[model samples]
Target: MKLEDLRGRLMAVDKKFKEMYEGLERNKIKSIIYDKMGKPVSLKKLSGYEIENITEKRGIVGVDGSINSYGGIYPHYISLIQSMAKSTLPKEEDIILQDVYVPLFEDEDGQAEDELKRRARMSKLELQAASFAMESFSSKVIFMDGSLMHYGIDCPSEWKKFKEKAISTGKIIIGITEEVKTKDIAEILKTELNLNDSILYDREVLFGILNEGEMLEFRRDLKSKKSESGIKSCYVRLSEDPQVAGLDFIEEQYVEALKYADLIYTLTPEKGRGIPLWLDIVDKEVKVTDEMVKSLVESTISREIREMLLNPKRSKRG
Candidate 1:
């Protein structure tokens, strides 16, 4: 019962969850197509959703970040056009991909720690904004910028609603993560369902391409951490059974996931190039760039903080 033993046990369980999920759910997969503008016109049509924005609430929002580095606010939009799916393959010609912009903000309090608190705050703001848009236009679906579990931890209200609806429909909600571990989604599911262990699996999933140069930054960070102290691990883990498939499988696997959706679009930032998610069938790296993460971080609390600062809190002591 040592602390390290317990931590190692948790990590082992995390690995087991990921391996199990990937092993079980690789066959059921689908994909989506979008245009350069980040609009899912082709996907909406493919999913049998109204192409003309028939629902007053049909649209995707991209977020990005603005940082005051060197005393100047630098706003960067994570940019990219993406297509998603579960088991079905997209006709290369039919894929009209679009770029989305999402912002990630800097955590004023924990910037020194490089804490991912911004991800939480930005996710909450994005959900709030998306929810307001949904209410304003009475939209049927809101394609959030990232994975479902990220939102659950960041914005519990929307996550609860999303889970209830997706489960009621017998639909597995798809979550895309710039980071690969499935821990966020699994945690949310376990908490929501109150299950000590439940079987979930990854269907057809695709990992976008990454070259050595593309991963250099990650290498540097990893190397730096090798000699650093007080560095907490952010590595995530999940439980799902997935099957192994080739890149060609992307079309076939994602198509199935698409069948469950009325519309499929990218609600993530364009910066990181694209957002990556786990595919049980493919046993390789699926890369979404850092640009996208930056976007969501930026958009999270920019306006809200400004407004809050302007409206000072009433003090009881005063």
Candidate 2:
């Protein structure tokens, strides 16, 4: 396409966006009037709580893993490295956990070629580790790195059992996601409230709707076909970066959910990007570097086997 054509398309999109913004404003006014009638409101401003008021016990645990596969040889192999961080606050201390698993590919019925199994193994490990921490600690809040909703239809019973155990222990399991794709709230606004133009992702619609240290709760119906996990979520803005994140918690734990959100906001640095420092520490501990992979392969494999391994032409040239 020519540069002039691209420029024209960009200008058209800008005009469309302006029209959509005006429509949204009009819908907000209608929503306010409807809210006064005591109807079901999807979004509301949160007040009466400040970040300085957050003084609760928090025990945060994060799990992440890395995988590397070598498929060029006769016997394929994969190296999986997993790490977990357990942190207790008020007096911050982190206990690090690490493990490595090496699986040899047998090529039996093509099962060895499936990558999803590897991913599932990592997920299962992470969940189990987090569950153990939840059971061992008496902290009011327990944190995880991703969604608590298990989307895998084929997930094992143990995975569900661990989550149940954590919740049954009366500790709040909070999942903080940097990126979210859920459209449940947006769908609710369109279907129940008859707002047609608000068909964007939940985060996009809530981009600037929340102020710093404020969170908007979203309740999902367990019987709704769209809600597979029956989990309740909220959108929170932790800093002044104009970025919002989705926080998922169990539906029955509404009051605890609000407190957990405030605690996260309190821990978030005011000057840096909006994320808790403990999460950052765990993320760095679990990340796998290329040098680490090279060292693992060199130290584990014999020199003869290393030479027998195949290398791509470009890698060999370098």
Candidate 3:
């Protein structure tokens, strides 16, 4: 069958399964945690949790740390328990987040593409982390923070291997990118709006642990005048439909990497507010506390920025 035809059929199947699962009385969704090396780790089993560890490799970096230099290596962990349509007890199959860390390196010859390839390699480590988490508790789905493919760069073989391994195990792999025009937004504001590129340079700018209220603010900015244009791609490896048994969703594209994937899922929302809201699904039921989001946001941002600044170009002093 043609690719489009296959996808449509899969979507139909997925929708059916989702409807079926929605009606079942399931209890508690389990979330898996993975480190930068893809090894699974124990996380506090709280819905809205903020975990911080001071590793010998990465310091006790908060979401507010720098993104481009040396510091502690950190990754974001998010697990949300979605309420099925039918309310029996409470289903325990939850989604796990693999916020992989990419190390910073100097690229003088415009080898930013290489950085993306490196990021793909870094993701392999995250997959290992997922595997370890799965060994302990069964999770319904794994939600990755980025794409299966390397963005703006050719994909490496490891990316394909990691993605396919996740699919064969009957676990859904859902990838989400909230802002499609992230690079463009950074550039546009850098030029048109005269926003500082230093904003991107700040290693602490990207990470955040936002509550429902703060999430709402970010979502508002995402859809309003602060809205940026680009493709926030979503990809799934299970069935194209959300109802299917093995539905994996990837929001971004890969030239050859996706070819190895059995089912690819995508949904282009008119508004780019799904991520923070989706995160709120479990946050509301748990009555998430302020400290949860605060610590997470601060640590994630700080760690990411410091990583980006790993190998900066030195300025020549007179």
> Best-fitting candidate, measured by TM-score?
2
What is the descending TM-score order? 2, 1, 3
Over the stretch 252-315, how does candidate 3's per-residue lDDT look in tens digits? 3222222222211112121334332332343343332345444554565665653454313342
Please identify which of the two predictions, 1 or 2, would achieve the higher TM-score against the true structure. 2
- Residue 15 in model 2: lDDT: 92
- Clash counts for the predictions, in order: 100, 0, 73
Work out the TM-score per prediction.
Answer: 0.30, 0.70, 0.30
Q: Encode model 2's per-residue lDDT on 102-194: one tens digit a residue.
A: 344333435444455566666666666666667565465666776656423325576567657766887677777767677755565455546
lDDT: worst 10-residue window of model 3: 58-67
User: Best candidate, lDDT-wise?
Assistant: 2
Q: Sort the candidates on lDDT, descending order.
A: 2, 1, 3
- TM for candidate 2 is 0.70
Name the weakest run of 10 consecutive residues (lDDT summed) in model 1: 31-40
TM-score for candidate 3, residues paired by index: 0.30
Stretches of candidate 3 off by over 4 Å are 1-68, 71-114, 151-155, 181-273, 276-318
